[model samples]
Target: MEFRFTVLASGSTGNATVVQSGDKTVLVDAGHSLKKLEELMGSQGIAGHDIDAVLITHEHSDHIKGLNALARKYELPVYANEATWAALERHATHVPPERRVVMGTGEEVRFGSMAVRSYPISHDAAEPVGYTFTEDGYKLSLATDLGYVSDLVRRSIIDSDVLVLESNHDPEMLRMGRYPWNIKRRILSDVGHLSNEAAGEALCELMTDRTRRVYLAHLSLNHNMMDLARLTVNGVLEDRGHFFRKDEHPLRDTHPYEPTPWDQIKRKAL
Candidate 1:
């Protein structure tokens, strides 16, 4: 079995990713418009019809903006926890009955050739969670849109072969930026998005020799820069003598607005 994941698009504007195992493909998040989601998937040689499932992390607009349309367009199953499903109904009103699948955190769901398990995350949304995918012994963890990493999250992703984790902002930048005080406080709170330092600290506890790649995700457009996020994560890893390949280090996707594909890392042996 072969497992592959791609960051089709990642940022505050919209978020979406593709995870594939052989002929089975699952889309995580549909934050962009239907057209935009199609373009992004097409750029990676995938079509809307090929998506078997859509797993949502939360009900935030940046994560589920196009979920209703995408699920309706492709007749795909959309899975989320009860609260998230309830929240999604408010935003993605057009999603039909059959397509809205309710899944609970920590429940293992399987597709054609892979298994996915969602774990609780520290986001303010309605029971937000991250996911872990395992296929033929290889693991890929996706944990973005989270404020801080919890012990449960650390346990879920510790031995992952590839980690797409959040490094949302720089604390200093956020504090001094123009976003309102309440928004800033929420961001800095435990249930808010992870700052670069917080993300790196989480990585320190999660990375191991078996971990092959790390992709820093969900960066704030106005508060954080790609270089700064990368530098912060790299610095943390290096300080602990856990260096990584240039590609394996946390890096940002270049085209935040377009359907983009990052270099796909092949599944590594366990």
Candidate 2:
């Protein structure tokens, strides 16, 4: 079976991704508006009905903005932990009870050929989590919107074939940016987002021989430029002697507005 992953949109503005294993398709977070979600998915030839489920990472607006409309329109099942569901219910009342699937952290849920599990993440939102999708022994993990990489987070994503990790900002740039002090402190907190340096260091520890692709996601438009993020990460990897050739371990970039090209995960030959 073919295992594929795509980032539909990723940034502070919004965040969403698509994970597909053969016939099973899952949408991870629907932060865009209903119209924008449609356009983003349509760009990748994925219609609403094509998605078998929606797995939420947290209750943050940037992660669940369009969830109500999308779930209601497609009659799709939405999964999240109890706290997140409780927090989300206050605003996304349009989502019916029958469509809500409250899952426990670290619990595995199957969607046909795909098996997905959520791992706890330290974000400012209620019960925020990251997801890992495993199919036919191949794994695709996504860990973004996290302030720092905890031991649990590191273990959860360790041997992934493809990883979509956050490279959110440059610390110095953020410290000097125009945002209010409180907002900056929130972002720099333990429950905030990860910086480029942190992401790079985390990658050095997380990357295994099985790891092939890494997508730098959720970049800040004001504080981070794509080239700067790439350069910083690569520099870190090189400095630590963990860097590999582009073909061996390609670092891909994701856009906040468009979908990344589908990345097929192929298992290594015995």
Using lDDT, give the best candidate's number. Answer: 2
Report how far residue 154 has shifted in candidate 2, in Å: 0.6
lDDT of 1 at 25: 94
Q: Write model 1 residue lDDT over 1-270, tens digit each, in one string.
A: 667878888888999989988889999998899889998898889999999999999988988888777887788998989988887767745578877888998999999879999999988898899999988777889988777787888999898878888888999999899999999999999889998888888888997767777788888999999889888877887887877676645444544775545445455554
Residue pairs in candidate 1 whose N, alpha carbon or C atoms collide under 3 angstroms: 147-192
- Mind giving the per-residue lDDT tens digits that candidate 2 earns over 208-246? 778888999999999998999999999888888885766
Candidate 1 residue 178 C-alpha distance from true site, Å: 0.8
Supply the global lDDT for candidate 2: 0.91
Q: CA lDDT, every prediction? A: 0.84, 0.91
TM per model?
A: 0.93, 0.97
Runs of candidate 2 with Cα error greater than 4 angstroms are 268-270
